[model samples]
Target: MHNDCAECPADSPDDKVFAVFWETQSNCQNLVGNPHTRFLTHIMWSFVEPGEDGTVPSEFQYWSQEHIKDCILQLRMYEICIHDVYTLKCDVVVVVAYVRFGFDGIDIDDETGNMKGTHQDWLTHHGPVVVNYLQALRDGLDAIQRPDEPRYLLTWDEFPSAWDPPDPTNEHYTGCISFHEDYDGWHRCYEPRISALVDMVNVMFYNIDSGDWVYELVLKDTLPVKAAAVIPKNKIVVGACSGQGCVSDQPIGQEVYNAGNGSAFYRGSNVR
Candidate 1:
């Protein structure tokens, strides 16, 4: 029912955008061999969180000797992963950063009580931090030299699913996934505002432990429908979570039929 040729700005004139959300530790060999990766225009690394500073840390941040060794191992893994992506087919691989905001309705600050910046109040009072966080991400993307042709994206995981420091009596301790939790007011057209810096909003829309029926509803209706109305259909990349994280029995790929919001890939229950 939607137009596949809808004009959107992913830096690609064609709208046949197929994006995939991949877990960092997934088997790189399996990924490169999969038919899916051969056509992905975007590859997103999910569940990646930054330090308490809520910004991208420099390479030197891993200062300690042990930490440096660990960092080297991780870097080698990523290097291999990125190399494979380029050899197969991929426009860009974006790193998903988790916003440090604790909760939407109550608080999203650091769990250690060090920082304070509720998601709901970010746009009004603490907007600078949000901007900085996003800017840091953009800078990192801009510096990518492997793919040579890389695209940038701004996205975070489903943070509102549960809070870190759960309280026994706090009513905000529910496990429900809050839609637009930290972004209740952000469901508007952002073309002129940030389309230049961000290629698309990768919605990490899976692995919420939903049943088959619930998962289908969200895949086909709940999230995408609402997102399309607020943001341009072309600017939304549907992300599927996989591996021990998802319990839904739904199949791996769930492309929204008749929807022109580009293409989507499902990932759950398995890292690969």
Candidate 2:
């Protein structure tokens, strides 16, 4: 969600969402009385930065562990419904809540404002390191799951361009199309191994030229491409942005609508 978290009307005839990355810049207090949040199954506390040395920290850097745990308590009492059309008439579904931690994979160099290493370095070196780090984080989250509550979620935000416009020249390049043109080489390095570690991935499909491209990415490219790489369709979430930073009309509202309808459509049928 955007920084203006409280502005969205409750139960509007818009797309329903499965989860949202609540920007850390937005006030958490706005969530307490907001009606629009009733549609959410998960709220991710975004942008907890990974270490420069490629490690995931046990504690959060953006907020204290206790503060986030308190926020999860606030989320425990949602009135989620089975059908968005009949939400007001539907039976109240007591949603079990847990905090979702989202991470960005890129690490920057302090001195020259460049990536710490080249694309090759990330593929051949840091890729395995990231996989191991996420595995440890997953193990930690699994350890904390209680019988009464749902397990905490670990998610990743990736550039939508990471898996598109099929790159075939390089030996390491996987078969995926190129959206950003120059990004095809980088797509070769997107580690599919990390897909199994995280609960879901939010592909940043914003600021592009067309809503159809976003739809095409979510439908034809993102799911099928990642599926070919062994990342399941259920683990992929179609991401969009609202308000200021994102351009208007670029994100197809129906993408989010389709995502929340059921298991996303891939090939001919619903996948889980």
Q: Highest lDDT: which candidate? A: 2
In model 2, where is the ten-residue run with the lowest total lDDT? Answer: 84-93
- Which runs in model 1 stand beyond 4 Å of their true positions? 1-13, 24-27, 33-36, 46-48, 54-128, 135-197, 210-225, 245-272
Backbone clash count for every predicted candidate, in the order shown: 13, 6
Q: Model 2 clash tally?
A: 6
Q: State how far residue 9 of model 2 sits from its true place (Å).
A: 26
110-219: candidate 2 lDDT, tens digit per residue: 11100334333344555665566567656765765667644455555455555554555756533432223333232333568877776555554543445575566555
Question: Tens-digit lDDT track for model 1 on 1-272?
Answer: 01122222334433544544444343455554444443444343323234444343332221332332343244344332221110001111223322111100100111111113333333233334434544655676456424644343343322212222223365653122122443342111122233334445444344444455645555566444544454455555554444543434435553343122234422111121
lDDT of 2: 0.44
- TM-score for each predicted model, relative to the true structure: 0.45, 0.57
